[model samples]
Target: MEIKIDDLTGKEIIELIGEHLQGMSLNSPPESIHALDLDNLKKTEITFWSVWEEGQLAGCGALKELNKKHGELKSMRTSSNHLRKGVARKLLHHIIEEAKQRGYLTISLETGSMEAFMPARKLYESFEFRYCKPFADYQEDPNSVFMEKELSHFYME
Candidate 1:
């Protein structure tokens, strides 16, 4: 899979993000949805990426600079056709590497707490992310589960 910085203007990616938002709406209440829309994702602090395989969009994710030492993960979604194909994994690894390169000491994320999000939670867990209290501007919410991973600059994977 080839991962590259995305400008959020492509038809395929727009549709994929739309599908992601639609899925979130199906599983979570409106107030509990923290996923950003295209406009928000385009903000200066957010770096968005899209994964393509054989010229087809496979997945996408973003890293948001919260501060000099901190970053946040956002909009991680694998296309339905690319599920279980390691798309999300590859994209996640890329994001983490980028965060480390940017001198971020820790990366945090917020995901759904529902049963439908079990797979997502597991994926983060596999990467050594630990469940934690809300971080950044996030607040404690029953519908949201927060996780964080400390990035050791000297640690080689």
Candidate 2:
């Protein structure tokens, strides 16, 4: 798989992001959904990436700069066809490496609290991302679980 900085202009990427939003809508309440739409991902503060394999769009994720030393992971979604194929894991490690390369002291994310999100929670835990209170503009919500990983001493595999 080849991961590259996405310009968000292609039809495949647009559809992938649309599918991500649609999935979030189906799984989470309206007020609880935080998946970034195309407009949001297009913002300068966010660096979006797309994972492609053999010319097929495998997945996508983004890193949003919260501050000079902090980042918020966003838009982490693997195509349904790519599920359980290590796409998310590879993309996650890529994001972590990008954070460390960018000098981010910490990286954080917010995910669903439902059973459907258990796998995601486990993935973060495996990366040593600890549970934390909401950060940045997020407020506490029963529907959400916040996680943060300090990159100051994070070891990349």
Candidate 3:
């Protein structure tokens, strides 16, 4: 699999993002949904990537700069065809490495608290992320599950 910075203009990328949004809406109530759309993902503070295998889009993820010492995971979705194939894991690992490279001392994310989100929660846990109070402008919402992972040796880097 090849993972690289995405231009966000490719047809496959657009389709995949649409599918992701549709899935999120189906799994979580609209009022509790916080997934970013294409316009938001294109912001300068966010760096997005798409993974492709043999010329077909496999998955995508993004890192949003929250502040000098923090970053947020956004728009993480593995194509249905690639689910359970390590595509999400690869994208997640890539985002964490990039966060470290960018000098972020912590990485945080907000995912759904519903049954549909179990896999995502499990994935975050595997990377040592712990449940936390909402960070940034997020308010307390039962539908949201916040998690964070602190970067060790951040100052040394």
The prediction achieving the highest TM-score against the true structure is 1
In angstroms, give how far residue 111 of model 1 lies from its true place: 0.2
How would you encode candidate 2's per-residue C-alpha lDDT over 1-157 as one tens digit per residue? 9999999999999999999999899889999999999999999999999999889999999999999999999999999888998999999999999999999999999999999899999999999999999999999999999999998665669
Q: Cα deviation in Å at residue 1, candidate 2?
A: 0.6
**Candidate 2 regions with alpha-carbon error over 4 angstroms:** 153-157
The TM-scores, one per candidate, come to 0.97, 0.96, 0.96
- Clash count, one per candidate: 0, 0, 0
lDDT of 1 by residue, 1-157 (tens): 8999999999999999999999999999999999999999999999999999999999999999999999999999999999999999899999999999999999999999999999999999999999999998899999999999999988568
Query: Which residue pairs show collisions in model 1?
Result: none
Top-down lDDT ranking: 1, 2, 3
Distance from true position, residue 129, model 1, in Å?
0.2
Worst 10 residues of 2 by lDDT: 147-156
Q: Where does model 1 exceed 4 Å of error? A: 155-157
* lDDT accuracy of residue 6 in candidate 1: 97
What would you estimate as the lDDT of candidate 3?
0.93
